[model samples]
Target: MIRCRQFYLGYPNSATVSHLLTWSHWIELLKIDDVLERSFYEQQTLLERWSVRELIQQKESALFLRLAASKDKAGVLQLATQGQQIEQPADLLRKPYIFEFLKIPEPYQIAETQLETLLCDHLQPFLLELGKGFTFVGRQYRITLNNRHYKVDLVFYHRILRCFVLIDLKINEVQHQDIGQVNMYFGYFAQEENIEGDNPPIGIILSRNKDELLIEYATYQMNSQLFVQKYQLYLPNQEDLRRELELTLREGTENASQSAKTLLDENDDT
Candidate 1:
């Protein structure tokens, strides 16, 4: 019989452990590898009071690295413990969305329509990929302008963010035109469709690839409601992502350190 003797041996002070998290949370924490990663989950589980199933899903999806994509170590820790409170607009943008649940293979690209259909067929899993608090509003959501009708690829309302999310699909790498078009969509929704007291509609141009520089510049200069993100049809090699993630985190930390040192040096001279 396999016993969690190692687990108990590490945290022999049961009362201290019990004061922090329940036995179920400790069981979930035992699954993670790194001390920091386990700690993040443990803290999040205790704070969010996530059921065992939610903890398993978060771990399986690599939630640590997902939030870490945009945030620093302390920020990621705060998010895990305090929960995602969308204070800034950037809080809504999580990059490199994985659509492994789409069940589509590579080298066989599907059009926006087919992709929409597949997503509808696999709604539950897709919703998980779309993140929490998103309710499907319908595919091919239509609006009219200048006596012409147009339909968006997908639509969802984020309960937490409190905005209508307009999504347009692109099989190719995102272009400036795509940004412009989705911006138009955002404008249209904000101008015509939005009900009273609703936040302005947020637009996302989902594509396979994009000029990262262009995406940043375009989204920044354009309306704040516009965003560009990529989706992978197949599941990413998590091992590769994890390795690349370590390199990215290290680079980010070093860059922050250098910037801090430069600022302090400038202050000393001035």
Candidate 2:
């Protein structure tokens, strides 16, 4: 169609010329109106080799918006050009991870055991949702210290980061004790499990709710790479995500402009 032709004509230097993507993938990507968003999908599809179905599903879930939410203008633009560059640990994280595949009903008051079971039952989709380079190691992995046995909810090895990812699932909001416990797990993994090439293990607490202030206080001055992220049982509202991304980018731009103006004003005073 005219739109498709215009897309190709507008971004002649795009990854569209590559043989990695098929016509079906292009058809799905063509639905995206934002050139930056479409370019991001195109680059990700080429890099990850996502099937047409997966491409459509990612688009529906607003993956780009979620990834762009925390990024500045340059980072957002880099996503369009380079897809996702997993050069560091934080790049592997997605805020408010989607778990619609779990198919849990209302009230959502499930026990931790039941929740872990559901995640194991739907492991494949969970891994995909967790993003790239994750391979499952075990569930209920046991760690012993001072004759006491402790079990971690889930364990995964991130090939890209070359580290172990320990996940602790909390049915409620994460508490201060939870952060301390995971940091303990990180110490165990770092000292006991890490091999010659392995980096220090990272710990994550996946909970229904997170108290930002609580987490900030809990993680203050901690040496470990620990994160507390919220997970929803349903897909996110794309419109809300879009608006949030816009607001975040606007704030980043304004902050950058303010900093530049302050520097210029100081120079003028000199």
Candidate 3:
């Protein structure tokens, strides 16, 4: 019986066993690779809430390049490792959202009221663009202080941020006064409307043109929750914007160094 068993388990049988084992190992590795790939895509989808089409669009748009341009090496690695997780649905919304849903033309020649109306019309998309946790409170919200009636262009509550966001739109260039005015609006909200758990209100002054230099100077002395940003009827070159942001950050570092030097010189003279 032993001799018969040895003959059955001959060289050909051993080779077949070895081949089967090799194929099984390959299949196992392939399964692991598939799981990792699926996890990556799933993560990205959650983070960006990217539709398959949108994901394709992002790839074509060089979204990774844009992200690399904007973020540091660590940030890029972190984003890559973590993948995309949409903590907020609003993060998925595009900024300066094209009102294509309204069948509006390329250059939307409309007044501020018209823009507000369009936003109201496409409320869902607008909220998405506004970012996570935005609930529209009102439009042209009126507030009277010191016998003067001032109207805020738009008011929103951000649940995640736990703050009120006051949006003021400007068709022209943003001015120093605009910053001050928004600062005041933030003050009013903080003093009057903000709930106990809410963070300080945020004021966004959006204009067709913005002077970064002026904004820097204006915000230097103020602690108010105000942010100034330029808005375009059509999306400007994202690369140009990224370049500008890099230059601005660089200039800030240079300015800080110069100020420190001046302070040291003054102290020495004293």
**How do these models rank on lDDT, best leading?**
2, 1, 3
The lDDT for every candidate, in the order shown, is 0.75, 0.87, 0.59
Write one digit per residue (lDDT tens) for candidate 2, span 1-270. Answer: 875796577658776477778778777877788888999999988877788887877887778998897788888889988999898878887877888888888767789999899999999778878888999999999999999999999999999999999999998889999999999999999999999999999888999898999999989999547888888888888899888777876887899999999999999999
Per-residue CA lDDT of model 3 for 22-124, tens digit only, reads 3323232223223323333334545545444544434333334343344444444454556533343223223333333445676557777787677788786
If ranked by TM-score, best first, what sequence of candidates would result?
2, 1, 3
TM per candidate? 0.80, 0.90, 0.60
- Residue 109 lDDT, candidate 1, scale 0-100: 61
Which candidate has the highest lDDT of all? 2
Q: After superposition, how far is residue 224 of candidate 1 from its true place, in Å?
A: 1.9
- Which stretch of 10 consecutive residues in model 1 shows the poorest summed lDDT? 1-10
Error of 1 at 60 (Å): 3.0
Clashing pairs in 3: 46-86, 47-84, 47-85, 47-86
Clash count list over all predictions: 0, 0, 4
